[model samples]
Target chain A: MIIDPSIIIIEGLKKIIESGPEFKITRFYQSNSITTNVLLHGIDILLVNPRMSKTSQFTKFIHDCRTENENMVIFALQTSYVPMQMMNLVDGVIEMDDDPSVIISKLRNVSCKTESANLSDNCELSSREKEVLVLVAKGKTNKEIAELLNLSVYTVIAHRKNITAKTNIKSVSGLTIYALLNNLISQTEMN
Target chain B: MNKFTGRNKFIELLNYNPQLILMLPRFGMKLGFGEKRVEDICEMNNVSSFMFLLLCNVYSFDDYMPTENEIKDIDANALVKYLIASHDYYLNHRLKHIEKHIGKIAKEAGKIGDVLLNFFKEYESEIATHFKTEEDTIFPYLLSENKQMIPENIDLDTLSRSHGNIGDKLSDLTNIIIKYLPAEIMPNERIGVWFDIIQLSKDLDKHTIVEEKILMPYIEGVKGGSL
Candidate 1:
């Protein structure tokens, strides 16, 4: 179960995630009216812009949201222009103006870390399986990823099957949700 | 890059209100009222009055995202450059260009241009005055206070009224631009310019809304200790 953030700003951020190669963000919000208790109960990462006035209340909101749901990652939008004193409460602070490519890469890194953390110490995801998972999070189709990863269509299908079994996501879209909640590919990743 | 020193387009585009431009910096007050700084910013940002006129024509999402090379760092220089190249520069330029053409257009289009320009002129002054107050009082005080000092008022009710007026004006200007541009005017050459303008307007609209509804009220609450 992946919970997408409800208080994300930047008008097309959700669209950017959907059109992106790595992941899709199904839920998002731009204000405090989102009722984080209800809206963020199952969300993975809360991509917040501090310049948002309601942002001041966000840390407390996140704290409360996390009391019930501990898996959420709250990433604040940091800007060089903002005084440092203003951004003390977020779990992770990412420069708001950082290039989308850099952001996506960073999200991938976080995602990878979280996914590996879920492993039972064996790192059992075969190299091929992990590669397929990465591509799936990138929002690539089995056929498209097969062409890019240089494997047969049947091999790609097998890898996806193993990934679903390991991740227990039932479907590729659900796997994407799992990837995003676990810090796989962020909505901000798409340029 | 003092290429604009004597040109008609440049002279007419000269700063009638450098104070308005001065408030544009995102962080520090780097570009004061000096001609040299203005010129530097204009050159660095590649801003011109003509570009502002072109920006009024852009309306689509494809026009919002800057080209790859245009995305730069958010440093002091870059911030100033963005204000100049993206916001104030285009705003000042467009206002002036419209001022120049509206008189002529009013004569030809009857009361249409008059109605439109009247709205623009009024809102232009309102926005300019509001921004000036922020520059002279609010922002400077925040920088100096080194601590947040809320304003006298910070409630959502006040914010809603203030923003409603400002937002409506911006919406009117945007609608006019999208509706008025003739189909034939070397539209492609102007495409890039309009894209930047639309983005600037969108960002400005969002920024002002945040400031009035969120930040201003928060500052007020902090100052008054109401929240």
Candidate 2:
């Protein structure tokens, strides 16, 4: 069976979309008719938030087009409290406030398990270790980390050990540089 | 309070003296202090306390801080306890837990997120020490009426040193989260983790506030002197 393209979200919501799923995503500008037409024909999912700056008529047109086709799953984004009745219009509503990871999980739950299958192999970093690495990347030394969390230096070193063991990047400086490159820490973090 | 993002105020304070982060080791070297002092500096700089203890106990980063022979010479259990309680229990657990569920989910999603899981492995011990430090040290000191019952070991000067390191940890962690997880549009759960991390850091800040605003004053009042 052919796997469908993961998502086609409206442009302004791209950050939310990007942060949500670790999958391939295409975006459509609010006014781009050809992009909308192509998205309707292709992607497996369409995520839109009505509160976008797009005109109501354009929004209506996109809605009409999406309603006519059932192949693509349409999700209307809402804040935490939209009326329950309005949710029936789309495949579902993803709360604007929902965790991006949660959204991805929900999408994966509905779609397929293929994406989750390979992630473990890609990084091999644990959640806490990743957190530590990200901080190391940002250039926080061991003592600073310890104090901020009310810990001693020894524990922070253990995390560094774990980070190095998993990532195969040995030095703290190297880890910091790596994190910065990976978008794990910002440049200003060196401060 | 403009949506309190979870940066450590100490690190933010250090940002004013960006050079302090670098001066740590040099100072450690200059003082000719033991592994504990170096570890304290590292702790003050936001290095992972969990990892630091492991390294000291395991003698991993032997080249930089205390030589293996030097650490071997010390009272091993006391040093180990110092490493574990001060670093792992106090710092790493809190910082890592601050990450909350979204970070957990992101870790699960990212496949490389074993850090989140490892934190669970060390959670109980870390939290125990954290609470113990406050309850055993600060609380009794603050609540004490009779001078004899109060422990001199839990003084503000000592806590302030710890606060310095913890503050640094907060700053570094905040910097990492802000860089990796930009605040554009995150899923609510991921946002929750960010918020949790922030809140936990804020809790530390509040703890410090208690030390500075409330606890310290009482201690001072009782002592009839300045901290």
TM-score of candidate 2 on Cα atoms, chains taken together: 0.30
List the candidate 1 regions with Cα displacement exceeding 4 Å.
A1-13, A16-191, B1-91, B101-104, B146-149, B153-165, B177-199, B206-227
Predicted complex 1: DockQ: 0.02
Alpha-carbon RMSD to native, per candidate: 20.1, 25.0
Query: Chain B of candidate 2 versus the native chain B: what TM-score?
Result: 0.43
Q: Calculate the i-RMS of every candidate, to one decimal place.
A: 22.4, 20.3
True contacts kept of each: 0.00, 0.00
lDDT of 1 by residue, A115-170 (tens): 55545445356677777876786778889998999998888987776664365444
User: Compared to the true structure, candidate 1 yields what TM-score?
Assistant: 0.32
Candidate 1, residue A106: how far the Cα is off, in Å: 33
lDDT of 2 by residue, A1-191 (tens): 01112223333245555665444453243322322222233255666554432354435645665664434566666643444444555566676467767777667665544224313455566666677787676667889888775767988877676564445455454456447546676656555
Docking class of predicted structure 1: incorrect
